[model samples]
Target chain A: AQSVTQLDSHVSVSEGTPVLLRCNYSSSYSPSLFWYVQHPNKGLQLLLKYTSAATLVKGINGFEAEFKKSETSFHLTKPSAHMSDAAEYFCVVPPNRDDKIIFGKGTRLHILP
Target chain B: EAGVAQSPRYKIIEKRQSVAFWCNPISGHATLYWYQQILGQGPKLLIQFQNNGVVDDSQLPKDRFSAERLKGVDSTLKIQPAKLEDSAVYLCASSLGLPGPETQYFGPGTRLLVL
Candidate 1:
């Protein structure tokens, strides 16, 4: 079975400050992890994906995440936060051979000026 | 490339009433998915289709929810005897096919309000 946990339900960051959203996952076998962002009234946009390629994955909109197998963590980060960066973020695990992708509860990001 | 398309951006219905949502996936994409997203939560997979065949639907409420992908192209999801808890956004997504299906493009989603 594969499952993902987003540590925070909401995160508030001041503009120009670093942003971090914590996520962890549990899987018997190796897993594929992803980070997706959703703006207001918009569909989800893929921020990054880790598929055994590299531990440090860089994605669009100056976002990045590092996959740590020992710690079982895949935390998203950015150097700075912008007002437009305020959105809902989700951590996802693709289906294993069993064929079922699991999603985290989601973290709502609030940018403070 | 054209993205996934969904109709009836918003719908308001009474409990126990039936409602339907339509979806048109990207051209040549053989995999389609339906997801339910409640407020303050991430999207949950409701069903998946591979070229007109059902792939996974374990989380769907078979008693009241059903979906069909006809001709391996467009699809529709119907909910009969809707419940208040069913109120959420129905998102339609499509991906290029298996054997390494990468990112799935999503539609705007239909927001349902059940009274």
Candidate 2:
């Protein structure tokens, strides 16, 4: 079955340090992927998406993701982490043959002051 | 543009009780989806609708859950005789149903706690 994999369950970064959240999709061919952020008791907010266009997708709040087809990865990255950036991030892919989309287990980002 | 809307942001109930969730998708969106999000896990697709018709509900627990989208607009999901494990956040999302499936806009979600 098709799936989205997010290896790290949690990541901690000191304020002003870089951040990385890895995501990999399992499929026979390339599919559009996306990143979304969720804060406590809040709805999800789209960060960025890769739809076979540019390999690098820049999103809101200074976050971005690069789609590497060869690696089957669409890892999210940010140069500097902020306190407000602490949240749960999810990687999503288009619906599979079952017409259901796949969501990675998510990676929780914690920022240290 | 207005985003998806869900009512009753929170609910608490005992096992075997019945509860329902309501969702109103963004105007002009042809597709609406319902998801179950367990703690520390990503959202799982429950059901999907396109223009008041069911597109997918393969993951839905039909024995205890039901959903419908009327007039291709507002939708409702009901769980009868809810189970303790049913406690989770329910999310509603909508898409324009464009050629590429389009981006999905999610609602604030309705959190449920089953005791």
Candidate 3:
């Protein structure tokens, strides 16, 4: 009953430019949201999480996401992009009190120097 | 602390061949999960184990796929008579059995290619 949709499959940005990866969700109850990054040939790393405590959440590597309940959105953003920031990003949502976590199709961030 | 560990970073076999992937979770973590990630898609949960007991496996293809966490520390996922569609990255993740909002730590994943 809970799912996540990533608006973009791929995004390209020049170095030092702002970056945004959009996501929308459908859940019956208040859900926990997370942003994870995966570098090539590497495992997924947690960027940040929202557990209903805060609407705006900051994460590692100058990344952050804002949880908008009214919009049913949790969009990841960064003020400036770096070469190392190029990776695949995923938006995740876990149904309330459920063990299964649903993930979006993912957005690949491309950094152009 | 060490992260989740998986074996056979890459594997290739014929469509009818069988393959197995292994995983070792972080110390003392009570939950382990197996996920299949196809190209350009997010990882999908194949099975979940809570301390050597099956918690959820609705998505697993039981006729061809099976998994087990015998000792609750390490786990294995096997695919028999594999199909081309089964070619994907098998990721292993583990997490503490906290009540809610637990972070699942992932492994580098085993990439399987069925030709």
- Which one is best on TM-score? 3
TM for every model, in the order presented, reads: 0.94, 0.93, 0.96
Q: What is the number of backbone collisions in each predicted candidate, taken in the order shown?
A: 0, 0, 0
Winner on TM-score between 1 and 2 is 1
Instruction: Please state the Cα-based DockQ of model 3 relative to the true two-chain complex.
Output: 0.66
Q: What share of the true interface contacts does candidate 2 keep?
A: 0.46
How would you encode candidate 2's per-residue C-alpha lDDT over A1-113 as one tens digit per residue? 55689989999999999999999888776787888899887888888888888999999999999989889898999999999999999988766543346777899999999
- When only chain A is evaluated, what TM-score does every model earn? 0.94, 0.92, 0.95
Per-residue lDDT of candidate 3, residues A3-104 (tens digit): 889999999999999999999988898888889999998999889988899899999999999999999999999999999999999998886566567777
User: Ranking by lDDT, best first?
Assistant: 3, 1, 2
DockQ of each: 0.51, 0.53, 0.66
lDDT of 1 by residue, A1-113 (tens): 77889999999999999999999998898888889888887878888988899999999999999999999999999999999999999998876743345667899999999
Docking class of 2: medium
True contacts kept of each: 0.38, 0.46, 0.58
Q: Return the candidate ranking by DockQ, descending.
A: 3, 2, 1
Candidate 3 achieves a global lDDT of 0.92
Error of 2 at B55 (Å): 0.9
B14 Cα displacement, candidate 1 (Å): 1.2
Model 2 over residues B1-115: C-alpha lDDT tens digits?
A: 8888998899999999999999999999889999999998998889989989998899999999999998999999999989999999999999887544336778999999999
